[model samples]
Target: MAFSADELRVLRRALALALHPAPLPADEVRECLQLAGSVDEAIREAGRLRAFLLADLARYRTALPGSATGYLELLQDALAAGYRPQPDDLASLRSLRHLPLAAALLARCQGIAERSVRARLARSTAGPSGAAVPAAPAPRTRLTALPGGRADIKPARPAVPGKPAPADDPAKDRPVPTPAEAFPPRKRPVPPGERREAS
Candidate 1:
């Protein structure tokens, strides 16, 4: 963003006044405000131009083989403006290497993109010191010792298919005999009838 000689003067004066406090003349204050507004407008214009360039770059990048020349120019411009190439950009550039400019960009961008990938891979697989970190152990499936192992001293019993399971005793449900039923009382002799005595 190039500032005109008059705008630069206004900005310089504004800064000088800030450092050395003084009552500003109304005209000078107005000039400073105008310069600030122009700066803001310039910033907004730059942003819009960047967005437009990126959009054009992406369009050309996709239609490669057809838009090789335009894509190469736009890519160089974007790279000059500090736009980092993405993985997709690298892939597209790879196919366009038949062109000299496309080949140059492909070489440059592949190095950067590959380095980024390698950095990510290193971070994922290693610790801060760069040593290979051990992965967590998987959970064991069998909780008890395996059969026939020294850890299991007792042999496992096999199921007998022909043998029936033992049932509860039926005598448990029968009632016990009472004491009166266990013994019988003795019978007494009967006396002579009163009618026989009278005869």
Candidate 2:
């Protein structure tokens, strides 16, 4: 996407004309159109180059340790071309990491993979329009018949900054047993001989 000095000058003039809505000379209009065509061609060529690099990378990856040197080189080039490292690329690099170059590439690929995953997770969690989705509100508690024989819905307690709300705390809903309820007294049993004498 590097433009020559001549192309940059044409682009600048074109931009100025676009902003000011001024009529251009016949030659200038022709030059602007030619520049636009050149830019489009460059974009198309870049896409084709990226596709070719990816295909080559995949082939090199499939060849594994045997193509470690070539694969590493191709991978570096592909990365420069804005190619995202695939799982196959990561695995290939991992297997060939005995080589110093492979080890470095593996670290680089791993970082790219982690960032890609985080980006995907962030996108998935976002709303359709890419805005963050708001959390669902907590459910309200329903109270049984009151003194007036009417059931009521209780509002959920507001969450505290440092502490969990009552509904979120499992221990809050459970009733604690008293000592007597926890451990009931056991009756003493009489001896068999004593029971027979009493009978």
Candidate 3:
């Protein structure tokens, strides 16, 4: 947030270039790139620090019943940094309501915590009816070919009038056609000068 004098000058130059159509000098460009990298590092460091603070706040909240003074100090720091109180935190704060500061923070965070809870409830509940509908059953599965050039699917058709149904057979489940049925032999082409032989 508090940039060095050189960084501020470079930032101003970058902004000026943005407003006016002009190319940056080679050294200025390099400096800008270095500044961008530093900014990225700062962002990452801030995130790491936030995570650490949240973890510490949780620990302090757990220690509230046994260590009120320490917990209150940490909680204040956590609250100052925009920490949203959990239900557990609210309960802990309620127990320390005898202390004026604890009571005040509890009142402040209570509204936010309640709104958060309501929002969660609204999301989880169904439509205006508030009723849950059962999911439909899955469709029947189709048979697929096996690795060894096989499939277990039998074609069934309605019998013609006055005709008997086909007999059931276990092997019939997997239809296996003869080689001729699968592919009939093809006739060879005759030469232009050759005569055809009689059967």
- CA-only RMSD, every prediction: 19.9, 13.5, 18.6
lDDT of prediction 1? 0.82
Q: Give the distance in Å from residue 80's predicted Cα in candidate 3 to where it truly belongs.
A: 2.1
Off by over 4 Å in 2: 136-199
Listed in order, each prediction's TM-score against the native is 0.54, 0.66, 0.54
lDDT of 2: 0.86
Candidate 1 has what TM-score? 0.54
Q: Give candidate 1 misplaced runs (Cα > 4 Å).
A: 110-199
Clashing pairs in 2: none
lDDT of 1 by residue, 1-199 (tens): 7889998899899899889989999999999999989989988998899999999998997787788888889988988887879877888887877778778899988777788889888789997898867788656787765677756444444657898644334544767567766766666655668557766
Q: lDDT (0-100) at residue 40 of candidate 3?
A: 91
**Candidate 2 lDDT, 1-199, residue by residue in tens:** 7999999999999889888998789999999999999999999998898888888888988887788788999999988877888888887877888899989988998999899999988888898898877578557888667686434545568888999666634566899889989999888899999999999
Compute the lDDT of residue 23 as modeled in candidate 1.
96
Query: Which lDDT tens digits does candidate 3 get at residues 85-115?
Result: 8788889989999999899888988987888
Best by lDDT: 2
Better of 1 and 3 by lDDT: 1
